[model samples]
Target: MNKKILIVEDNKTLAKLIAKKLQSALGLTVDVAYSMAEAKLFIARYTYFIALLDINLPDAPNGEIVDFVTEKNIRTIILSGNIDKEFRKKILKKNIIDYVNKSGVDDINYIIHAIQRLQNNAKHKVLVVDDSRVFRKQMQTMLENLFFQVISVAHGEEAIGMLKSQPDISLVLTDYNMPVMDGLELVIEIRKTYTKNELCILVLSSNEDEEITALFLKHGANDYVKKPFSKEEFSCRINNSIEALENIQMITNYANRDYLTGLYNRRYFFDTINEYIDEVKNSGEKFAIAMIDIDHFKNINDTYGHDTGDKIIIALADILRSSTNPHDIVARFGGEEFCVVLKNINQYSAEEIFNRLREEVEKFSYHLKDDKYINFTVSIGATLFNEEESLEENINAADMLLYNAKKNGRNQVVFQA
Candidate 1:
């Protein structure tokens, strides 16, 4: 998507103010055109991510610029001062994103938020389930217009299967009545596995029965949209649902992550690893659990102060996060101590992995004031998984080896399988 915007407003002062805001706030390229003629030239020269068009312009007075811009396949939003009910209604019918009254700075802020919303919409996928092929296509069109990745199915059963295969799908829009599996049944089936926080479900039906609406909401449907809805209402509901889901996920991530390093916290690691362990435990595969600690960390902190010491810890965490495979787990247990799990590894490979990690930390340089630098080293201890032992035992075994490594010398890896 182009990081550029075209604003066609006749008022020079208002146009420049909005342009400044778009450029400064969004870091986007802004092109302002005072009339339809200039807009045509700009549209011909550059492909814009979105266009803000004025209904009344010097060259085109009767909202002719809107049709011209829309014909160029540019996504448009009207920044018009015209508040006539008939004119607003007619202009909105064009495939434009929105109509914002150019009343004050408040409207400019809304435009900024709307652009941010559109950019985020691309991250979500919406599943549309309707028995009528026509309705399915209509919903698909509207969703795509709002920049959402859309998947359409003819019935509710296919919707379930799609969710299973594509669990990352963020929202489901289903018609209440369908063959094989009705929308209500689909909602119940979906709630069996996914929570409202995990997935959003909205029912779309022509039926206005209040009892039916209550039943759908009672059975895990986030919302119900009646058929023949306006584009503004539909857009608002979908955006709000996605934004809510994003907020919930942000909070969940904050809870499970370390504050400074942004790695998985100790609690999250232990809490989530059991299911993975169960899956691979009986596969006759060997795994390595290791304890890593910054050697003489207290001395460094004492000499450099706690702030620099925190910097070193953060640097080491970055190394661990990047050096390991994506499937491998790395966590900060607290202070200068860290833990790593090398999945599906052999005895020799595990030792080599830990040794490489030790070398990486030893060579890293943490710079201080002037040209001075602090070189740090780490101690590592690793143990292979034992079929008969609990996870705690394996961790204890590794911790003991870490102790031995520090005892023998401060910068070494002690491996015991």
Candidate 2:
């Protein structure tokens, strides 16, 4: 089912506007409730991913709806016209995702952004490191409220271990003062492995020293949050940092991936394989490089048309991706041709893998349209790498083997014994 949202605001105009924007921008199904009773009925009928509640409803004037939705375990963000500092503080203390003052267009835009951030948060893991157990727990709760998977450690040492074990962690929130290692030292050490684009580090400190903040940023911290930060400011900073990282990642992915097949492009394959070769050279490990080509690809394109040929190529790419191990590097070399690097594998294992893949492709059938179908197969040529040989030499060997495979017959695995 599509994720749905609920907007409970007595102002019919503003509520519908918010709903419309959400529907158009995020493709979310939004249900608008003009009163607390209507919202209750909607809540009972369908599960909502999040709800935007007004502080003063006709029936629940004192933000009673916040409690009602929270009781259902639905995430809540308040859209109230009240900008009173004490009231905002009180509402923020209630463990809501965010409390937006519905006073202007910018605030509504903020609400939209917060929702987007929340959606992205589900894909990220955050690590919170602090010597104070209370602060660590507090930050963890806040991060969790933003829909992030949060792990809290009591000190910087533990944080380092966590990062080592959980390489998927996207953000680290650490305190300045800690036992064993401080946040600054942790940032310095983390920078040794991960760049700012790869991992986001945010420093949280009560210290008012400018040099301290500068030091953290100079070392590698992406941003800093003062200890007594407001809920809105904290949420904004965290989201901004995460969003920036995501943008960088998206650009990197576009650069590395083939536009059509979504596999690593030829350039990326060479770049990555060079590094892999270097690592293998140091470890004295054997690897295999395979060059794959679809058999009779030009004939298929000339007979069935280029569109159908494209479909066949896509189907074959899917097979290559699924048939290989996760650690293997798969790439689209160009039209109807592909390459893969199988790490720590001998010639025997490489042959077995490619033969299995060829069998699967030969057995598989492709449907073009209603009552129309086509079938295709692949020819593979692979070579086990010798650390002493150059990359160009290994590639040439694989290409020669591939040519021989085509010369003998199609749908075969050719490799050096």
| Top TM-score prediction, candidate number | 2
Candidate 1 per-residue C-alpha lDDT over 1-417 given as tens digits, one digit per residue, 9 for 90 to 100: 788999999899999999999899999999999989999899889999899998889889988998898888778899988888888888888888899998999999999999999988988999999899988898887888778999999887899899999999999999988999999999999999999999999998899899999999999999989988988898899999999999999999999999989989999999867777898877887789999999999999999999999999999999998878989889999999999998889999989988998899988999898999999999998999887889899899999999999999879999998
All candidates: TM-score = 0.92, 0.93
Alpha carbon RMSD to native, model 2: 2.1
lDDT of 1: 0.91
- lDDT score, candidate 2: 0.90
Residue 155 in candidate 2, Cα distance off native in Å = 1.0
- In candidate 1, which residue ranges exceed 4 Å CA deviation? 279-285, 299-305, 366-374
Q: Each model's C-alpha lDDT?
A: 0.91, 0.90
